[model samples]
Target: MWQQKKANRRMSGGAMNSGKWKEDELIQQMLRIAVPIALQFFMLACVSATDAVMLGFVDQTALSSVSLAGQIQFVLNLFVSGIAIGCGIMIAQYWGKNDPKSIEQLMPVALYANVLFGGVFTLLALLLPEQLMRIFAKDAALISGGAAYLRAVALSYLFCGISQVYLTLLKNTERVLLSSKISSVAVVLNILLNAILIFGFLGFPAMGITGAAIATVFARAVELIWAYLAVKQERTGI
Candidate 1:
C-alpha cells in the first residue's frame, strides 16, 4: 500500500508538471496573437486622435463638424466589421483544414460585399453631404463644416473598404505581424500629413478640416497599395 501511494504521488506530480507547461504555452500563444491585434487597434485609434487634436487647434467648429461627420464612418464600420468577422470565421475554418482554395473563393465574395457597402456610403457623402450632416446636426455652420469634411473623405471609404478586407484575411492567415505593420505605417503617415496639411507646414496651404479629410484618404490609399503588393507577392489570391 505504501509503494502504491508513492507511485501515485509520482504520477500526480508528473501530470501537474505537464498541465503547467501547457498553460504556459497557451499563454505565450495568446500573447503572440493579442499583442499585434492590440497594437493595431491602438494605431487606428490614434488616427482619430490626430484628426481631433489638429482640427481642435484650428477651431471649435472644425472639431465639432468632423466629430459629427465621423458618425457616418462609425456606422459604416459596423457593417464592414460584420462582413470581416464573417470572412474571418470561414477563413479560420478553411485554414485549419489546409484549404487555400476555399479561402480564395470566400475572399472575393467578402471584398465585393464590402466594396458595395462602401460605395453606397461614398455616394451618399458625395452627393448629399450637407443633407447627411443635417441628419446629425441642425446648426448651419456645423452642417457646412461637416459637408466639406464628408465630401473630402468620401473616396476614403472605397479605399478603406478594400484594404480592410485584405487586412482581415491576412490576419487570419497567420500574417498578423505584416497586417499590423501596414496599419501602423498608415497611421503614422496620416498623423504626419494631418499636421502638415491642416496647418500648412512645409509650405503646404493650411486646409484645416478639408486637409484632415485629404490626409485620411491618402493614408488609406497607402494601406490599399501595401495590401495589394503583399497579396501579389504572396500570390494568396486576395
Candidate 2:
C-alpha cells in the first residue's frame, strides 16, 4: 500500500509540472500580444498629449481652438475604429480556418469604406471648416483658429484612414510589434517637429496652430509610408 501511495504521488507531481508549464506558456503568449497592443494605444494617446502640451505653450486660445478641432478627429476615429473592428473580427475568423483568399476579399471592402468616410470628412473640414467649428464653439476667435487647423489637417484624413486599415490588418496577422513600432516612431517624430515648427526651433518660423496641424499631417504621412513598406516587405519576403 505504501508503494502504491508513492506511485500516485509521483503521478500527481508529473501532472502538476505539466500543468504549470502550460500555464507559463499561456502567460507568455498573452504578454507577447498584450504588451505591443498596450504600447500602440499609449503612443496614439501621446499624439494628442503632445498637441495639447505644445499648443498650451502657444496660448490659451490656441489650445482651446485645437482642442475643439480635435473633437472632429475624435468623431472620425470612432467611425474608422468601428470599420476596423469589423474587419479584424472577420479576418480573425477567416485566419482561424486558413482562409487567406477570403481575407484578401474582405480587406479592399474595408479600405474602400474607410476612404469614403475619410473623404467626406475631409471635404467638410476643408470647404466648410468655419461651419464645422461653429458646431463645436460660438466664439469667433475659436472658429477662426479651428478653421485654420482644419484646413491644414484635411489631407491627413485620407492618409490616416488608409493607414488605419493597414495597421489593423497587420495587428490581426500577428505583426503587432511592427504596427506598434511604426506608430511610435511617427508620434515621436511628430512631437519633435511640433516643437521645431510651433516655436520656430532650429530657425523654423513660428507657425503656431498651423504648425501643429502640419505636424499631425506629417506624422500621419510617415505612418502610412512605414506601414506600406512593412507590408510590402512582408509580401515579398525581403
Candidate 3:
C-alpha cells in the first residue's frame, strides 16, 4: 500500500510539472509578441524626440510653444493609444480562435472613434493656440513662437489619429515588422525634411519654427499613406 501511494504521488507531481511547463511556453509566446511591440514603441518615441530637436534648431521659442501644445495631444493620445492596443489584443485573441471577422468589425469602430476625437482636438488646438501656449509659458516671445508652431501642427491631428489606429491594428495582426519598417521610413523622411526646411538648406526657404511643423505634417502624411497601403494589402489577404 505504501509503495502504491508513493507511485501515485509521483505521477501527480509529474502532471503538475507538465502543466507548469505549458504555462511557461505560453508566456514565452506572449513575450515574443510583446518584446517587438515594446521596441517599436520606443523607436516611435525616438522619432518624436527627433522632431522636437529639429524644431528647436529652427527657433527655441517655437519649440517651447509647440512642446506645450503637444503636451495636450500627448495626454489625450495616451487614452487613444490605449484603446487601440486594447482593441488589438481582443482582435488578436479572436484571430487566434480563427475568428477573422471579429478583427474586421472591431477595426472600424476603433478607427472612427479616434478620427472623431482627433477632429475635435485639432479644432480646439488650432483655434486656441495662444491660450494653450499660455498654460506652459509666461514669456511673450515663447508664447508667440509656440502658438505659431502649435497652430500649424494642430492640423496633423486628424491624419495622426487615423494612421495610429491602422498601425495598431497591423501590429495586433502580427504584422509588427512591416509596421516598424513603415514608421522607420517616416522618421527618416521627417529628419531629412527638418534639416532642409528649418535651415533653408537645399534651396528651401527658412520658414523658421513654422517649417518644423510643416515637416512633421509631411512625415505624418507619409505614415498615413503607408498605413493605407498596408491596410489594403491586409484586407486582400483577409
Candidate 4:
C-alpha cells in the first residue's frame, strides 16, 4: 500500500504516468517478460556447463582449454549486447515519440555496429587464437587446445552479430517470449550438438574441443536464421 501511494504521489503531476498501481496486472506483465528471459539465460549457462562436462569426458586439457577460450565469447557478448540493448532503448524512444516508421531505420545502425565490433573480435579469435590463449594460459597444451577452440568458435561470432539484433528487436516489439524461445531452442541445440560432436556419437567423428566450437557455430546459425525468418516480413531493409 505504501509503495502504491508513493507511486501515485510521484506520478500525480504527469498525465501519462498518473494511475493506480494495478498490482496484479503489473506483476503478471513483469513475470511474462522476465521469466522467459531468465530461462533463456539459464539455458545459455547450460550450454557452457554441458560443454565442460562432455569435454571433461574426452580429456582434462580440452575441458580447461574450452573454458578458457570461452572467455572470448564473454567479451563478444559485452560489445554486441551493448549495441543490441542500445537499439532496443532507441526503439523505445521511437514509441515515445509516436514515430513508428523510424523504428525500422534503427535496425541498420544496430546491424552495422554489431558487425563492426563482432567482426573485429571474430578476426582476433580466428587469426590470433594462440596469442589470445597465451594471455590467459601458460601451459603449452592448454594454449594449443584453447587456440583450436577459439578458431573453431570464431564463426559463431558472425552468426551472433546478426542474430542479436533480431532477438533484441523482437523483445522491443513485445515479442519477448518469442525471442526467448528462439534462444532457448538454440541453446538446447547447442548442448545436443555438443554431445554428438564432442564424443562422436551416432557415427559422428569425435572433434573434442573443436566440435564444441562447431556446435556453437551451428546453434548460432540456427538462431540467426530462425530470428530472421520470424521477423523478416515485418522488416524491409537489412
Name model 1 segments beyond 4 Å from true: 1-8
Rank by TM-score, highest first: 1, 2, 4, 3
The models' CA-based lDDT, in order, is: 0.93, 0.89, 0.79, 0.88
Write down the worst ten-residue block by lDDT for model 4. Answer: 13-22
| Predicted candidate 1 versus true structure: per-residue lDDT over 1-238, tens digit per residue | 9999999999999999999999999999888878999999999898888788889899999999999999999999998999988998899899889999999999999999999999999999999999999999999999999999999999999888888889888888888899899999999999999999999999999999999999999999999999878877887755
Q: Candidate 3: which stretches are off by over 4 Å?
A: 1-32, 236-238
lDDT of 4 by residue, 1-238 (tens): 9999988977775644434346667888899989999999899989878988899999899999999888888888999988988888987787668776787788888998898888888899989999999989999999999999899889889889999999988887778998999999999999999999998999999988888999999999999999999888656324
Q: Which candidate is the best by lDDT?
A: 1
Could you give candidate 2's per-residue lDDT for residues 71-166 as a string of tens digits? 999999998999989998888788778887888888889889999989999999999999999999999999999999999999888888888888
* Lowest lDDT 10-residue stretch of candidate 3: 229-238
Residue 152 in candidate 1, Cα distance off native in Å:
0.8
- Highest TM-score model number: 1
146-218 in candidate 3: lDDT tens per residue? 7888788886788888888878777777887777777778778877887787789999898867777888789
Runs in model 4 with CA error above 4 Å?
1-21, 96-98, 236-238
Runs in model 2 deviating more than 4 A are 1-5, 236-238
Model 2 C-alpha lDDT versus the unseen true structure = 0.89
